[model samples]
Target: MIRLALVSNKLQKIQLKVFDSSTFSILRCWDPHLSSSRSSSQNLHDPTTHFHNEEALNPTELLNAQITSGELNEDKHQKMVVEELEKVHQNLQHYEPAKSTMFTRLFGRRDVMDSPKGIYLYGAVGGGKTMLMDLFYACCKMPRKRRVHFHSFMLDVHTRIHELKKTISRNQTSKPQPFDVIRPIAEDISNQSWLICFDEFQVTDIADAMILKRLFTELFSCGVVVIATSNRHPDDLYKNGLQRSNFVPFIKVLKDHCDVVSLDSGIDYRTRSSVGKDRIYFVKSETEADREMDKIFKMLCSMENDIIRPKTLTIRGRNVTFKKTCGQVIDTTFEELCARPLGASDYLQLSQAFHTIMIRDVPVLSLKLRSETRRFITLIDTLYDNRVRVVISAETPTKELFLSEGHDSGHDDHRMLMDDLNITAGSENASSNIFTGEEEIFAFDRTVSRLTEMQTEDYWKQWDKKR
Candidate 1:
């Protein structure tokens, strides 16, 4: 009997619930009969076990069994990805042995050459693609492993190669080998049947898309298994667009590498966010939220004189930094600066980082639609695009605020985001987050705005004299 189980975190308690056949309705999840961990807290030491079926032998327990019995290599090649990483599994499954030749074995091959094995999984947004990749990762528990978000992993690659190129330019070194730096990591995976998982594997930005061929090709040669989940379909990747043809070979490489399994679960998992009634927390006081902003004010004020590294700022006590911020421009690599660089995981860090962002009165520029203005527009666009839950205290609402007037220009960067990823902004239906009878379009906005205005005023006042 084939069975699928779901493990979800509800009320901060991670529960492993079982589903019935046919409709997959909840059959049994929280059974008092199964008490691995005595306490309600999600314990790290709890027995993590899941039976393959009615058979008593649980896959997870089997893993644990191997761990204790001095068999470190016990089924590390196969793992059950916790539900959180289902999307990753989908991507890893992209390589299956059946539909693939020896060359097409990247995503589709069964791990061993001796057996009949191949599987692929592909899908759209919030459909638990990463979850599956993670499952593949968990199964292959080789000690030498790496799992990175696509952007950060690319940024690191770019950084290393850039340093090496600089050495070549200096003529101090005859030839700098960038491969030496990242190869050891790759070799670790190649040593055995290794696993590599990349989250949010989409390439629209020129900086990343341009280098995909070389970077991945290098890793591919080193025998590292490449598994990635993307918003783009393989053939249509970066299709019919600027400098997009350069990415064609990359698409081919990916196609040749992994068997494309279009899971297309046809069901969006994101809608289940409101599955059970969660909390609608309200501010303790009208100004309580403001005080929280003050905490941030104190930090920034303290650092005003310091020409700190752009990648070393802390937000709400979490180490936060920007990727490309420098000289007359705040060119940021939010991907690199993000807490974990793994998509939705970073959003939580961001929500906790800043309560209020105050942009004191700078001249309301009636500027033209230049690159700088466009980039700034892109910055804000990206911010809201991610549904950053913050109190935005601006002179005007986002649509009108900071917008240069009469700029009839359109930008590809802004429009590049697809509708699937643009999950509509969180609702303001007066729950605790919006205590004002659904009156507040945004619960966190007003308080954030008020505090931000005050802070921005203070910031300008303190520095204006020098300017």
Candidate 2:
């Protein structure tokens, strides 16, 4: 019996040593039994260990370290936001997820522990909201956590809802009810992630707007905490959107669950250091632009041994063809990319396939090209989120790409739709809910901000590292 006990103790020690050497060390630190007895500094000598001490995981500490290292400039606004995020990071360290009991499940009661209030950080374009949020998300040690672009999250939500409805249709044994799938979908998301960080949170689509209230209500009830950064305030979201009255309650829910913070420091940080530093964006005559793009393309292609050829990407059973591709680089035109009917999903596929994209002949956009403008916005958003590099040849400078003065003729189709729905100009909600080019104009500011940032050396370096 003494020999058996000795062997058992030896095996347990070996198992612990293995865990401490691997990435699982972080998780082991969260274990109550292990954490109670172990000092955080005990693993400091081992360089393989991720965090040296509990303070190492603090978002504020990390932010200040970056500032000290000159990787980031000291900004009072950014400092304040990180201080708030530090509180959240500390709270999550001690958070224990409440488990559902059989009695609670049977009675449809959620027995959930109170979670820390999430944050909603809003500011003007080019502010450091995303940068701070990213710092916080990286420092969070929770295993059940997710960081996603808001548009991508909504797309996933819509896809899941569709699949769920299809499954219900195929299941013959289940009795048909009202067919509401939001609660179940929310539960699935909550099970996957207890903390969700969203970048660029906005609501423009009516389909998404209508479901926000129920979805978030269920998520909050399930103790799923949310942290989001946006240009618009919660009340300003879905402004002038169709059936926006129904979406207002979601704003209330969001405000009730989150402490809203404004990070407008009167400084556009992204534009301060990097504008016009990179020579990728060329504003010249068509012929001159073409020559410049061809020269750059050839230079890039020479680095790869693969022959230049046309590439086709199949997304959702649809084929999207690019005329020129060399290995992971694609040379396409603005007309070919934005003139066609493409969306977030299509752009996402392109971003995945290409490390660098060269776009030529991007003309000054007006309301007449509203569809193309919207597509361009989606493409930029997806590419930026994925850290994909973009080179552009445009008719005007980046700041002048989108013209603000144009007749609202592009929204005639919207007006016709409203007329068909018996929502006339005289209707009480027509002024607020009518679709127009103004929303596009408002969104173009963000697109312009991103485009300017894309031209910076730091942005290119980041993309190269990601590639």
Candidate 3:
């Protein structure tokens, strides 16, 4: 039992059970039973005999220490926790039971979708969106369901459409045999009562933007209960002239199908003032790009590259491949080539032939636009989908390879970037030797380590493991 304190991101206080170090990168650990009630805690084992016993950390240091320790993801599990805590914080007299409102038509009819009595969590960034969803996920006791990110969720949808296309394409004469777990999963997903929870539910770009209706419409008609945490207001989603109007009917559909609620009651979770020493991701210059490339390559080299089975999968075409593995790849359109569906025979047929993927003409990571920028997203999608831990990149310094829509000279880009770097660096797990005799179920994620540093094209061959 590890009693955790991430003073960063609004000085949060949460508890978690640290099962083991086999797959986790726990930075700070403490036995819940032995935790001191006294606010001042110290590392007595430190060689330096001195300690800063400050009384109550300022918001900045609280945020910094929490940020530097890499615990922001855990923070997402607190929306409901905070709501539960808010009751305690206010010191209320009694518990208010959730009221019934089927007839009111807040979203839909009573007993709709067979009334599975599931949860629906929604909120803004740092507004305790994921926190509530994760808490419910941990506490819920139900058989048959799946939790996934919106990106991976869409990938599964793409894979499904792709596979359905294949299943029909084969035109098999035999009756559907004993239900294969994977075959009926797509159809089964609709029949069962699924408590789907999505984090960071913002729609971006043309690809994902187009399919919003068909995807969720299928899910809703099939009976999937969604609990989502988002940074945008439901109506305000897909902001700007991003062709969101095409998704308007789906927005109405979402509002009609789900119990929409707001959780904007407290402080911004990202605004914790106590975090100490801000960390910044470097933007590389043309002259020093070579040095940056080495830094990124070393990060990948210090990792374990291995195969992993995807938890949620799509059986596309006759191909036996699954579209999602680590389930991080998100796209609005155009399925990644590696994620193309495969049937049993189709998979066997393409084994040695589809071995190596050749991503041609990858661009340098920098402010300048590169031809391969779109391909980078595809590369990331395939790597994440196939669970390919070992990625041979011709591109160097990830930032250079994935060029951002360069600064518009307005809006707090610098500050927002600092916040993004601070948040991502704060959210990741540290790399240790994560490989042993035990078969690895998850990817080693050399991509993140490389992505953390500046990517340079000068040493492209260095990223290849074969050399």
Candidate 4:
């Protein structure tokens, strides 16, 4: 009889809740090994005991138990994924090799062993791929393991390459080829993590697409195993891009190195969950709006209450402070963001720091508020591009957030806000229109369209991905 129990990190015993198997619909999760009774001699403080308790549970059994306990929605496809992940975990456990290091290379050289094949799980948004990956990552006992979002990982890769190039140039050593920097970066990753799990493994950026083949080839050579989850299949990654033909080999390498698995249980759990949740709010009173936003913030933060704290981000030597943040969920005022002279870089930095953002008091973007409106447009575009989740309390609905000032009062058409802007469905011309003499208004139109989409359950699905 496995009953769900929770133990506080402070070593306090918590009451166990048992649900009748017939009526197990409401669910929560904790370590299943926790029992209502413990012997006086049991060493609750032992780290080894905690580690063993985690290992006692299998991914499939744990997930099934979670479902049975009403902690998760039961889905056959998700259970199948648990089985696949279990295999990968077992393979990793059985894999035998000394940790890759310079010390081993010099003093204790050993033959390179074949690394275990990893899985590439692909599916529609909110199908529980991330949930399974989280389970797998938690169950992995390997000391050399790392799980990172693909976007952040690529950013690190690019940053490291830049630093390496600067070093090479400053030292006046041998001229390094453009491809030469990838080896050390991959080697460093291999040395640090034998098992690498990437969330939302996308390759839309041309810079990333160009170097992935060489980079991953080196990674594989150095014996790093990878598990990644994505909405796109390996063959379909970077579907149609500039110089896409050159990026095809990397897809083959990915296919050969990993088992591509798809999980679509024909239901989006997030969408189902979002049935009664409000994503976009139109509020006239700032006080009520702030209170509602705070409630949502607390809900997203969950039981890790202390994790909610302010974060200061340094964007190109400028210090920007977010008033409230819990893990990757952030809360800040629209005035704090748009009133400043921040640009795309600042918003991009914010996107990297937080996956979900709650912006309070978004006023109508009239022509008089041109600078703030421009900044707001830039911020939203960056957030949309990075797939960040945006929750807002605005003075009006999204469609009406931007309006002509005094157009009804017979102001000049050119003086009207909408007259100066010519926006369309999907174009980048909106940012330049007001001052750059560009006719395209699609940037703001697309921004408005994105605002609508972001409010949907589909866009919220991607919010689960790490920032």
Best by lDDT: 2
Error of 2 at 314 (Å): 1.9
Which scores higher on lDDT, 2 or 3?
2
Scored by TM-score, the top model is: 2
Q: Give the least accurate 10-residue stretch of model 3, judged by summed lDDT.
A: 432-441
lDDT of 4 by residue, 1-467 (tens): 11222335342221212223211211121121332332222110121222355545667766765666555777889888888888888888878545567765455333568888899999876577766886777677778898876766887888889998888888876765554788778778787887898876876566888999999997887778899988777887866544567889999899888999999876655434432134345465534776657666654454333477788899867788877787777878889899988765678788877767889889887655666877886787568657677778988877778765432222343335434455332334223233332211223554565576566543544433222
**3 or 4, greater by TM-score:** 4
Provide backbone clash counts, one per model: 40, 0, 46, 5
CA RMSD of all predictions: 17.7, 12.6, 17.7, 11.5
Q: How well does candidate 4 match the true structure in TM-score terms?
A: 0.60
Per-residue alpha-carbon lDDT of candidate 2 for residues 272-384, written as tens digits (9 for 90 to 100):
75443336788985348777677667655644557899999999789999999998889999999999988998999898888779998898997778789889988998999
What's the lDDT for all of these models?
0.37, 0.76, 0.37, 0.65
RMSD of 1: 17.7
Model 4 bad stretches (over 4 Å): 1-55, 96-98, 101-110, 173-179, 274-312, 316-357, 361-391, 394-467
Ranking by TM-score: 2, 4, 1, 3
